[model samples]
Target: MAILTRAGRIELANAIKQKSIYLAWGQGAIEWDTQLPSEPSSSTELTSILGYRKATRVLYCDADEQGEIQVPNGRYKIVAGPTPHLYCQFNYDFNDGLSKSIRELGLMVGTKPKASTPSGQLYFQPEDIEQKGTLLLLEHRPAIYRDQGVRESFEFVISF
Candidate 1:
């Protein structure tokens, strides 16, 4: 196998980072346990698009807790998972930034279903929407790296 240099890895990582939708349990919570708004999120109580990607701490990814990517939905911009993000810590794990598993609940990443379909966008489980539990303190951040981390701001998308 070929080895990636630090710069190469960052470039590759950044390139792959875009085209993805991400969610982290934010400092707020949704207490009603409701279904995700299948309609345009504008009409729902989804959190505003501000303060996303502000978590400067390094996020920890794991083997067991990887994302469940799904096929393309005519609905969302990027299609992926419908997994229930039932849990995640309210604050960033500031210890070492190299934790094996994340403190956040479920993490959704990977491809939308199809041949040659792209990967990395997140998806919501229709059943998990409005299930009547506390809302996960969610921070929806999409990683769209224009210059691979040198862009003005990181691009995040709530849907898809």
Candidate 2:
């Protein structure tokens, strides 16, 4: 749950200077996965399918609620896309005795979301984020998006 600790501020500062960061979305219960990086390290990685989905996107680190380089905490919003991305769709129904259901949403961060082998990935860094992925900031949260076709907007807030 801790993105940047007191000791990781230096790395966080360097990461903040990057033009963009990778955002990986997934489905699961509303809880922190053990795979999430408690702190940036060489071995942090994501494994479970419930906590990981292939549909990933590159996002700008533009915090709307605060400045771009807000230290203690920085917020980044993923503007709603035109169409729903994978693992981001939602459907609900109350017909059969309250059958309303939704896919849990989780967020993770990395240097890049390359779809290639570990070694072939761009901006690959083990400590920052290896091919396996890193920084699971958000655990699954049930979002009620009745229109599955419409893209959903998401926000990521990280504090150092």
Candidate 3:
């Protein structure tokens, strides 16, 4: 069997750093008023999306002997190591997703349309853009009830 070399893995990780990535949140189905939503074993996309936001930070990081990712510089940069560990950070302002219950999160890859200029067509809320991308990563957890004055921040490490 042919095994992929460490250099080959670093190449793949470097390639991923060039893509446009976004973080999306959704309100998945609930069994009842008392039951928390459960993550489906497999899903092509989020069941019900609240909104999508461009990643605040993306980096190629290294992992320790025990597979724990080392701390990366805060700036957006790529530093490929022996292992392919992609770190991603997403931040949502308090005004975003207000009064909604978020039960699922996904990492997506897609293009930014020509019409999507920051000044002309911003994507700060759910209605700003349609779910038009490949879902790369998915996570389901207990519902988080959003409030008007609370901001949401998430950090994820994707090992390729």
Best-fitting candidate, measured by lDDT? 3
- Residues 1-160 of candidate 1 have per-residue lDDT tens digits of 8865555544543443443322322212233233232323232223322111222222222113233322122121222322211111123222312222222222223312333323431222222222212222233323222232232312122221
Across residues 2-80, which tens digit of lDDT does each residue of candidate 3 receive?
9987778767767776787888888877742367555555777888888887888887665444444333323223455
TM-score of 2: 0.36
lDDT of each: 0.27, 0.35, 0.71
List, residue by residue over 3-122, the lDDT tens digit for candidate 2.
Answer: 645446535534542423444333333343333334234424332332123323333343456543333344344443211111221121222112222233334444344444465332
* Each prediction's TM-score versus the true structure: 0.21, 0.36, 0.76
lDDT score, candidate 1, position 36: 32
How far off is residue 45 in model 1, in Å?
26
Candidate achieving higher lDDT, 1 or 3: 3
TM-score pick, better of 2 and 3? 3
CA error at residue 32 for candidate 2, angstroms? 13
Off by more than 4 A, model 1: 1-3, 24-104, 111-123, 126-160
